[model samples]
Target: MREDTFCWGIVGTGRIATIFAEDIQQEPGMEVTAVVSRSRDRGHAFAQSQRLRATVTDSINALTSSGNIDAIYIATPHSDHLPATMAALQSEYPVLCEKPMGLNVAQVTALADLAQKRGVFLMEAMWSRFLPAMNAFMTLLRQGAIGEPRALFADFGIDVPLAPDSRLFNPALGGGALLDVGVYTIALAHKALGRPTNVYGRARWTETGVDGHSAYTLAYGSGAVAQLFGALELNTPQQAVLCGTQGRLTLQAPFFRPECVSLTRNNGETNHQYHPVTGNGYGHEAREVADMVRRGRKEHPTMPLAESVAIAATMDELRTQWALQYPDEP
Candidate 1:
């Protein structure tokens, strides 16, 4: 432990939490000093497996009030994100909650309001926003490397076994293709085009009554458009393309965490750029939270609470169109 270490208290000992613990260790001044899980046994196992000299407890209060932790990372299931994040914010601890933030617009809006009232640092762990390649990609777009953005295309898809009770398919767990992997596409489009003026979408539901596959189009007032897709039962190419008046930029497969991008001009010329990731690419966001907290910043500029709210609202509209509602949503 160094004198300038930034300590984290992680909630949930699941896969995301484990990855975060492992990646944070790669950062010079950051560490996961404590963790809380629904099961104390699991918490202990997570600590030992990660070889972390940290505390393992089942009480979020104890972890938050430990006096040594600088922030809290909530990696619970989608349905549990709101409650877990609320607990951390109520404790006045900065929080980095997992993506989607909550199951619906209302839940996410409430969390944003609370974080504002409490004046604590709160960010959605949209790790892709902090990726080196993503930063470069955004930079090129901003610099007009592709000209005025006219349209964008992105998708995320995976083939997972059907399990009604699993996190990815369970209605009780707030499961669906839209929330599970679709958020990356939505967020990427939001970053590139801001809020859309109109959205049109439809979904294919699973036997469990959740969306197994979804596709949507977002239209902007400036005539910019984004076509996005997400699926749990189909393995669609996980790539993204942004087209403009002068050229187009393509992010390779798995665009969410892509390392390479190519820009193609109308003149039939293309240029490739690569920006390598660090430590599974999770540490970059963790470092951002640490840096923001150390500087007394309330939120990260790239991933602000307002944009999160708007993204949630966009999903809310789509769900409204599909007549989809989670068991936990009011």
Candidate 2:
């Protein structure tokens, strides 16, 4: 809890949890002091790999209630986010939850309400927003590097084993291309253009009836349009471009992290490359959380709590248009 050294209690032992652990570990003033998994075996495995001298518990309550942890990071599955986040916030622990805060907007909205009423620090761990490349790119856009942003073209796609058990194809676990990889594309669009005045979506479903390959277009109140795409059935460029009246910006693969970034103004183009400054570029968000907690702030100004709820709402609208609903959802 000290300002100079923040301790993180992580919940969930998934792949993203590993990345989060790595990123938070390398932060100058942060350390992951504990981890909670569904099973003791899984918890110890993560503890051993991360090489932490912290407590490993199978119980979310144990980790959230511990005085040893200064903050909580929830990296559980899509369906599990609400419980983990609710538990942490209810314990009065500051929390940084993974993106898509929950399976739907209603879930996240309630959490936000609780956070507000409880006066606990809470934020969606939208790591991409804190990336060096992303920040710089946004700075350019603000400076009219891309004047009057008119359109955004973004996509993410990959070929994965189509097994029904896989999270991408399973409807019961809140799995689908839109909620998974597609979220990244949509998040970027939100940054460039706020909420759209209208939303539309269409998708090709998998055998399990979840979204397989899909595309959507968003019309913003500013008269700007964002064309987005996502797919688990095939491979895509995984790139993005924002076009405007004065210029355009192009982001390389993994547009969220953007190993490469470029700016074009009326015909002249300049490029910049950023290597992993830290573990998977997630350390940026970790550092931001530490600083915010140090300042006793409840929400990150960069990725405000309100905006987090809005993104979830946008996703809900998209899913509705496609008539796609997870088994556990209405």
Candidate 3:
């Protein structure tokens, strides 16, 4: 490894971690040098598959204090995000944790506070926000291509089998459509509308006690609203739309990682655009974190810690409405 290369230490060996490792490998002057997993055998296998010439351990402490890693990425299950991220921050490591950041608002807020006190760089891996297409969409909105924004509609639903042992339906693993894919819808809404004046939601519970299907509406002070839906028990279009006084923008299916968007104005004028990504779109966030760390910044402006806390609060409110609580959550 080059002395100037930015080395990363990953805290999980799951699918997302594998994707991250793959994407980071495509970046110049960056490398995955260490990984932590509960199972040493799995960690070793992951390293070999990813072709990482790095350490494979089961301890977060070892990864954080190796004196070689420049930053850490937490890709563990939802329930483990808090503990893993906490360990990284306490060890004075910059962290880019996966979405939902924590199980609830309290946990997310605590992490933000700790990172602030340490003056270290900490950001939620809301990777979608950094996508090329999403950025282009935001730029158009800002330039009034959609006029005054008035409403939004988005949903992400996939039909996964009813396997109680899988993380999707397991309460102990922080399973549920809301925590898993629903955050994308809410995040897009939050990006366009900021914090909602009020949040209204309803959920259908699974036999395992977690939410199976759910819907929510966020109300803003300017009379704007966002309608969002998510489900693990059903399949949906997985599209999104933003309506304005004079026009509307629609993102193609699987909107969270969209490549195309269409804008139609009231005057019957229309425009279509495409924005492509490199390496599954995970490298964008990795590069952003590396730039911020090298610049000595403590937080990302686009995916700030405060906004992550706010989004977690919104999710907490929805869980409260459904009377759903994870077993391990305090």
Candidate 4:
């Protein structure tokens, strides 16, 4: 809350939380002031490794009660985002939660409404939308570089060893391929095609009663369709393609962390490569949140709350189609 810097409180000590802590340490105007984890030893170790002056605690109430943090970053699992975010909002601290934002659309809407009522800034940590390359790509699309994006194909999948109780395969933990990795593809599709009129999905479920692989086809009223695939049992190409009447755009490997894009037009093929980002590409989102809070904004202009709701709705519909229900859903 200081004029020159923002003090951040991290709400989890998981893998992603560690990455975000490191990234925050690298930024000039930000500091990790506290870290909350169920394991006191892990929280203390994380704080020590980052050389951060932090109040490490296992309870959410204890972490938020310090009344010293300017903002909180929710790095817990998708199922835990809602409760953790609510805790931060109740404490009058703005929140930046990692995507897909929630286990379902209702959770996202409730959080957005709560943040609004509390007059606190809330942003979903959809880091891809904050990347420089994605920003440029959106600009090009708006400028008719691709002549009205007509179709999009995106895939994100990985081969993970099957452990029934692991979060990735556990139904009680909101585990599935769609929530795990397909959310990225769905977000991109929604970005290019808007909300779909209809969604069709097919999945291969694991023995542990969770989806191991899945495919989705979304039909838009504009006569465009997006084909998306995600899996935990296979290693996919994990690329994104946007095709229009005039040209096509291809994002290289790791579409979410894309650093290069190729555009093919009637004139010729052009390749654009973005500068390598510092601090594992998470600094972009951190800086974005800081800028928004500094300007007294409630949400980001690029990735608004409505977009988050629509993306969650799409996932909800996809889940309905595949008959895949997370324990958290109802």
Candidate 5:
């Protein structure tokens, strides 16, 4: 663990991978040193475009065993995260995998256990948890700015075109509205409130048997409930609302990357808070991973391993209720 700069290797060249790679370049103590893609040409092209010296390789074995990369970021499809993380773990490399950590709870538990036993750092890329505004919102909640939170309403849905062959509709790729976007809504609910005691969900499945729309309700022990919805067939407001005894907080578009929030008091007075991010919000998560590695920590304090497991478990339960089984799930 060096104090100066941490070397990173990207495991995929997808859209998310490109965004993260660009964000890494902006950070001071982080650099993307390598990229692994199934196509060597694509890997080389992505690396060159980023202006980084990369060892392009089509083989995961070669990329992991090169002994030149510090941590590997898994940006592959949801179904591929497990295998990719395992490949890196086998080579004694730490991993920061994209969320929903695995296709199911059992797989997530297995991978988390393996990483722990191997004494390697493993983190889920739930970028929302590392954002500045989210941190401030949590702080405000803790300080009783919103009083005792009673309910949370959040929705994240996009107008994804219906294509049976696309990953969004392919059951084999762990495609669905829940795993694709609902994970963020669930995470937000969990962050604001603890794990729910009762969970119920209703979903509309696509022709290929994948969920295109899902609405879930989670009941906590304190009689608080979280209402969340995710859909690929519709364009939702993509907002988040936290209601408490004294006031309510509302976030604008893209609740996951919210830049502004409004708090309404019991007296009907509203106060708006704005946080301007320095670079793309992705850099915050990258800096967090770098700092964690520098401090010799295996998991982030904000996004703990336990939280990842719990979120997976919740998603697993919802999928089971909706009969949404992916090809990767055993």
Candidate 6:
């Protein structure tokens, strides 16, 4: 490990954690030097699977307090996000908590306050924001290349296997299509068209009481509207469209990490493609976290602490509309 490198203690052994470990090792200036799992065997197994030459611990304290660790990446279940993040914050370590940072807005706000008091870097790992194509897409929207963006449409739905114990359907684990994949649609739409003034939504609930499918609309004060939806039982096209007065932009399927964008101008059939990223794209966010910490910044400008809470707030309202609540949420 280079002396100037930032070392991350990964606090989860799930799929997300695995992807993070695989990607981070490929990047320079940062490394995942430790892992925290629920059980010793899980921790060891994860470390072995990742082929990491680092310490593996089952306790958050052991990993968070390590002198060699520079930050903590909370990739645990949604229900574990708060306690894991709080522990890392209390230990004076900056954190990159995965999206849906908490169960609800209140939980997210508490974390923001804690991180502020601790004066450490805290960011919701909404990785899409940092993708090169996303930045370019934002620039195009900002530059008025598409004229006035009046409406947006986005969706993220995967046909997940219905296993009650799986995080995608487990209420106790803070699972559902909304938190698991819907946040991406919300985050992207909200970024392109500021916060909405009103949110209307409906959903189909699983027998386990979690949201199985949901559709929602966000109305902005500027007359911009966003129609976004997510589902756990069906697979939609997973694309996103931004329509403006002069032209339109469409991020193809898998919009979250899209590699191609389509721009149509002046109602003509003329189409243009913009491709602007390489690799799995998780490195962009990790790179941002490293840069922010290096500059002693408490939060990233693109994905601030406030935006994280606000997005969760919208999800909270949508859940209310559906009358769905996780058993573990207070």
Please write out the lDDT profile of model 5 over residues 190-244, one tens digit for every residue.
Answer: 8999898989899998898888999999899999999999999889999999999
* True lDDT of residue 270, candidate 6: 52
Better of 2 and 5 by TM-score: 5
Where model 3 places Cα greater than 4 Å from the true spot, the runs are none
- Which portions of model 6 miss their true places by more than 4 Å? 269-271
Q: Rank the models by TM-score, top first.
A: 1, 3, 6, 5, 4, 2
Please provide, for model 3 over 1-330, each residue's C-alpha lDDT reduced to its tens digit, 9 standing for 90 to 100.
Answer: 999899999989888999999999989999999999999999999999999998988989977667789999999998999999999999999999999899999999999999999999999999988888888889888999988999999999999998999988999999999999899999999998889999989888899988898999999999999999999999999999999998998887779888888899989798989988788888988999999999999999989999999999999999988888899665
**Preferred candidate (TM-score higher): 2 or 6:** 6
The digit string of per-residue lDDT tens for model 4 on 1-330 reads 356888889988878898998888889988888899889998999899878888898877898777677789999888899999998888778899988788899999999999899989998888888888887677777888789788899999999999987878988878889988998899888887788999989999999988899999989988888999999999999999899888988877788888877788857777675645577788999898989898889998877889999989988888887777877477
lDDT (10s digit) by residue, model 6, range 1-330? 889998888999989999898898888878889989879899999999888877988888988656688878999999989999999999889999999999999899999999999999999999988987677778888889899999999999989889998988988999888898888989987799978889988888898888888888999998999999999999999999999998888887788988777787886765656666555678889888988888999999999999998999999999888878878665
Candidate 5, residue 66: CA error in Å? 1.5
Q: Global lDDT for candidate 5? A: 0.87
For candidate 6, what is the lDDT?
A: 0.88
Candidate 5 segments whose C-alpha is farther than 4 A from its true place: 1-3
| Residue pairs of candidate 3 with colliding backbone atoms | none
Choose 2 or 3, whichever is better by TM-score. 3
Question: What TM-score would you give candidate 1 relative to the actual structure?
Answer: 0.98
Superposition TM-score, candidate 3 onto the true structure: 0.98
Q: Per-residue error at 4 for model 6, in Å?
A: 2.1
- Quote each prediction's TM-score: 0.98, 0.95, 0.98, 0.96, 0.96, 0.97
lDDT of each: 0.92, 0.85, 0.92, 0.86, 0.87, 0.88
